[model samples]
Target: MTLYRQLIIFTVVLFLLLFTGTWYAKLANTRTFLTDQLESHVQDTATSLALSVSPHVAQKDLTTVEGMINALFDRGYYQRITYTDPRGEVLIDRTLPVKVEDVPQWFVKLVPLKTPEAEADVMAGWNQGGTILVKSHPGYAYETLWNEVISMTVWFAGCAVFMLAAVGIGLKLLLKPLAAVERQADALGRGEYELQDPLPRTREFKSVAEAMNRMTVKVKEMFGEQAARAEGLQERAYHDPLTGIGNRRYFETQVGADLGEGQGRGLLILARVHALEALNTERGLQAGDELLKRVALLLQEAVSGYGDAVLSRLTGGDFGIFLPHHSSAEAEIVATEIASELGRLARERLSLSDNIANLGVAAYEGSVTLSRLLSEADLALSAAQSKGANGWELRAVSGESALPMGQQQWKESLVKALEERRVTLDAQAVIANTKERGVRQLELFARIAQEDGTALDAALFLPIAERLKLVSAIDRMVIEEALRFDFRSIGVERIAVNISPTSLEDEAFRGWLHGYLKGLPAGAPHINFEFSEFAAVQHLEMIREFAAAVRACGHGIGLDHYGRSFSKLGYLKSLRPEYVKIDRAYTGELLSGENDSGFYVASLCSVAHSIDIAVVAEGVESEEQAAVLKELNLDAMQGYFFGRPRPLSSFTAA
Candidate 1:
């Protein structure tokens, strides 16, 4: 039982004991007082009657003596009154049975009131005439005692009830601080730091609350320190000091990993500032640095609308940009935009040469070495430098042709595909690292089959769809397909589909998603919608609301590419997604020995698991990587090492 109930019960028992003791004492006192009153009443009446009857007895008035005795008996105060002659013969006699009225029989038996009899002589002048006897009635005594007992009991009962209620309320108020302490402890367990407010007055409780507050603050500081250390390590290793973007090392590691996997089509642009050494000789190094910073800012602004575009400082004057899943036709537009911005920078006197920069754009597809792409872009750069001031060029490597479709063609193709319902479902299993090697769940990717029988992954088409405001349509179609899947046949209880944060912004899409989830069959597999961490951070409110609505229908949400953005880890506490798939860029850094990536991954796992969130490492293509991840306390692993993406219909019971 709770302390409140225990205290109330203890109070009740104590009150009952006190009532029992006081009530018994009162009963004993009442019985003693009544017995004395009865004795005195009988003695006084007998003496007075003897005196009154003496005169009558002296005259031998038998009728008068009998009348006097009868008068006293009829009064009912006396139980009996009798008169006798001097020779011991009875002259007049009257008696009534000893009985009590208006009192319970149990009460009378429990407390027997004494009825005392007393006698006095009736004398004629100097001799005794006769002896008169009188006995008092106990009925009046019992009535008085019963009334006092009833009144005392009612008063005690009322007092007990009022005391209990007052005590209960007081206890609840005093214990309010304890409730706050409990909540604070729970929040701490979930990696949330909450302090108890309005310190308690009680000394012991106040001490406890202070200690808890101190501990909470200490733990929060520790978490912040760990997060900062990990982020600092990541920054020093991968980010450029000058521009606050990725350095050449980060670009090679990330872009190489993406192209090595042969995932899809993309473009790489290499821009070199012209005559930077000459400019630095004319001005100071500070001015050259200022000029470079402006160029970086202009490049970032020009491609700000594009998704997953990586810009980096390759060397002193050469910069690199990699756009994943971007078409060749858009490549020229991006190149010319950067070139036009550089020309404006020259006009603003940031550059001494009118030929401020030359951009060499190279398109790539499928698996290829990083060196080959760089070589191709370098040749194109040489061609641009020969052309004139602020010139640019676009080229593709010898055998492979770039994706020929432009923005308008992509819009037309995506719209038609959605209209024709030409989407196909592909799934890859996330396998647990436990001894059972069980499949955790399937991650679904939407693919559009082209007229030539070539399938286009969402990575290749989603950016275009989002740009054309057709992402919600694609998301809706993918969800409908996922729901129609036969999870029972594969013995899988859950599946996850990617969801664009943009889709959640559409009121109609949100309504349809909620309705569809609510109408699912009773035994349908639970659906988990995934949002990239970068996009999720941008639209947290929308995702939070959508998460709440879907969770009401037995669904949940997860974060994909988790560590790709520079968003704070604190949001994870509020978002509380079902799981987070660590970005492949981090996963690609895992090696057999100790490294910064291992420390970073371990830190991520610690932060996530403290809040009961599962951490998954995606893109685990080698046993060494998986073994390294397994030691990092990752909940699951996903990538080609387990299996490649295949048709959902091909899945069967494991």
Candidate 2:
């Protein structure tokens, strides 16, 4: 339970106990006072009546005595009234009907009310004639006591409610500072070394806050000092100090890790500035260093979109990058981007020297080591130098292959593809097994069709589009097509469309998407937006904003290709995505012999299930794979064995 609730309950309970005891005491005192008042009132009434009736008693006038007694009875002051002569003989009597025996006789006897009896001597002319007597009614006294008890109870109940409310509010305020302290301590443990705002002026809280603030300041100062030292050492260990890019050691470490794990399939690019020593000798060392820095900056900016792609200055004038998880087309796009940026920088530096930067790129796949990747890239670089300066060559693993067009050619093709509306949609089905038959879901895929009506595979052209910085245009086209598609006719319960991370970063693109989605037909509830786990993790804040925008339009968000990178499961709980498509690699190995893929998949399913996220297995190619996934209780499955990628026109409504 929260501290606020616990504190409030404790305060209210304690107050109730104290209030109850006090209320009981007040009730007892009121009852006693009422009883005493009744006793005194009866005694006085009897004495006054006895004196008044004495003359009649001495005259032996029964009628006068009876009249006086009847007057007292008519007043209704007593439950029972009795009058007896001096000889103790009954003369007049009045009593109420008995109903179910009033308070138990034993209980009444234990704490009996003392009914005071009054006596007077009847006389004629101040002489005694006969004795008149009166006794108080116990029932009347009991009734008065009961009335007082009811009044006391009502007052106590009202006071208890008021006191409990007041105590609850006060306790909550008193514990507010303690709650703040706990939150601050939690933040500190999570490595957020900053103190929260100042606490209230409670003495104990103030002291603790001051101490925490001091400790945070000290820790931050120490970290800053240590970071400075580490930066200096890193410069010597892994960076080219003049160029501000990684040195040879950094290159080896990165390439080694990528090739060692076979983590992602991609190309490596190596480039060298020719005649650096000659330039330094003829001009000056300062000019040469400036040239290297310019080249390093150009390379860095070119591959900025490829998250985790590493660039380093291997040695004098040479730079390299391991493009993990990128295809041959992606590598070519990176090479062109770098080459263009370098060309611009070279032109600006031409006023100082007549040197032009040259570039080289290579693409490889299928279990390559670091040495082989580097060697291939270097071979391509050497080939580019041999052909001519200010040019680049792209080598493939099969042999050295040359790029036919320049950056302008690639850029024009991407622009034309968007303008011509050549993008087409492909979809894969997600099936859910229910008691009666099953449910079919579709995932949207983007394909580029050429002018000749031949559909170009996404694998061939997406890299080029991205390299030309036209991914946002392609993404927008995909969204437009998805919105326009009639999925209801095809019986697709849900249509998931992939949104690029690059497009999400563009505020203009986000605005355009929101406006477009707002105008979509009201009956279309099947459209769902998706973003890759790798992209979402890299630009978390941007993706989150996009997801919120999508959800506002009455659609849901999904994570595609989840588990591409190691991510905290906590994000799943916070983002609360509707579904996640497990990465194909994990699914492919799930049924491999002598492997524990079943356990791994089951664990992932369990975690996702815990947060109410539906998990779908991707790239399931066999019945065995599907059975294993079903055994794990996977929510859905998609692969070639079940159904190959096809156009939306291929399927009909069920």
Candidate 3:
């Protein structure tokens, strides 16, 4: 029960006990007093009658005594009157039958009043003779007891009502402080850490209130300190402090997260100012920085919309944006607007002799990772820069007539590469450092050999393949070829295959992969599919579905270039991949003077380990970097210093 109800019940019970005891005591005392009064009246009447009838007895006047008895009855002071002779025989008796309506028979029987009888000895001139007996009636005594009980009941009921009202009011006043404490607790639950108001004068309540207020203040201070620290870290990680726009790191992180969620079609616009180095040389650093800031502002204003869009300064004169759910047409519109805004802002603010800004727009249909997007946008921006001042261009579609001949030729070559399965798998050996045991795991890399016997590096052809929407088909072909290679004969337990973001976006690719892997020979537990952090994050839902399908077929998922994003780490818990490869940018600088890189790498390792995610250090070229990574409890290492990329047949021969 609630406290209020319990208190009221307790008070009522206490009152009833006291009231019942008081009533019982008063009733007993009243009964005793009435009995004494009746006894006294009986004695006095009997003595007086005996004295008055002594002369009559001596004169032999029985009639006079009988007449006196009748007179007493006429007085109506009793229900019964009797006079007895000295010989123990009744001389006169007067008794009336009980009336039905006078009093209840049960009540009369329960509270029977015993009126005492008194006797007086009558003597004639000093001679002892017969006794004169007189008895008092019980009805008069019962009447007196009933009147006393009625008065006591009235007093008790009045006191009980007053006590109940007083107790109820007092309890409410006493619990008011507790109610305030409850309200404060509720507010705290809602993340409001304000202290409760002052409580009442009750000592217990005052102490409790003070303690609660102190706790609230301490918790608020702690959270404030944490928030401040988080904000400081965010500023260092995400913002270009000088320009007040997002930094390159922040831009990369945001794009990675957007791609991971597959929230919108990936569209990135990279804007760069041509001749920035020359401009700085000619106009000085101050003017150049000011111009860059103006450009950033212009870019920010251009992409402003209800949906998610971010503009960030990636470098000195380069700015980047990731627009959500934007189509190719929408991207072109935004690019035009940005180009116009940049021109206007330059003319208004820079006081430039000529317009110096160039904008490059690139839109991806499905999942596109930050690295791929950056490379494509950069390529487009370079094209614009080469064309001279104020010239802006959207990245050329592979088959579009606008593409240069070289790009068009490259697109045809990539298509030919796919049809002929000219793509060859190159394996880089990732060897664990040990004197007694040297086991190598191959990291699968793709190389495209043309029909003319000219091999193309992924650095050149992969971006073109992605631009032409041919990456997924190329990635699928690579996986199929890797599975065909007998890695067991090469003394390798596992091989890693790189999967592009576009590959994950292809729903049919996952089904084909599942069907192919299901036919793999039993006990072949060595094939692992690797995805870059940017690519994996771009198509997280698809990646998850693909990962599940792969694992079902005895393969596992590994995240490459991990920690390249600034999004929530919660997805890592859900993905729960076999391993996370630390980004090369971080691992490559492990031996350098940059302590923050090591710390960041270590923090990622810690977080991943907490969720049972094994950490691998990518680009660990030096023994020193490898040692440091090992000290951080990294699970694996890969770099050119350990092994270089070679053809699959060469790997098998080794």
Give the deviation of candidate 3 from the true structure as CA RMSD: 15.9
Model 2, 90-122: lDDT tens digits are 677766442214455554554456555565555
Mark the 10 consecutive residues where model 1 has the least summed lDDT.
Answer: 397-406
Candidate 1 TM-score over all chains jointly: 0.80
Report RMSD (Å) for each prediction in the order shown.
5.0, 9.8, 15.9
lDDT of 2 at 627: 77
Give the winner by lDDT: 1 or 2: 1
Model 3, residue pairs in steric clash: 86-130, 86-131, 259-537, 259-538, 260-537, 260-538
- Model 3 has an lDDT value of 0.71
lDDT (10s digit) by residue, model 1, range 208-300:
999999999999888787677767766877788987777887788778767755557788999998778888899989888988888889988
Error of 2 at 608 (Å): 20
Model 2, residue pairs in steric clash: 122-129
lDDT of each: 0.85, 0.69, 0.71
Which candidate tops TM-score?
1
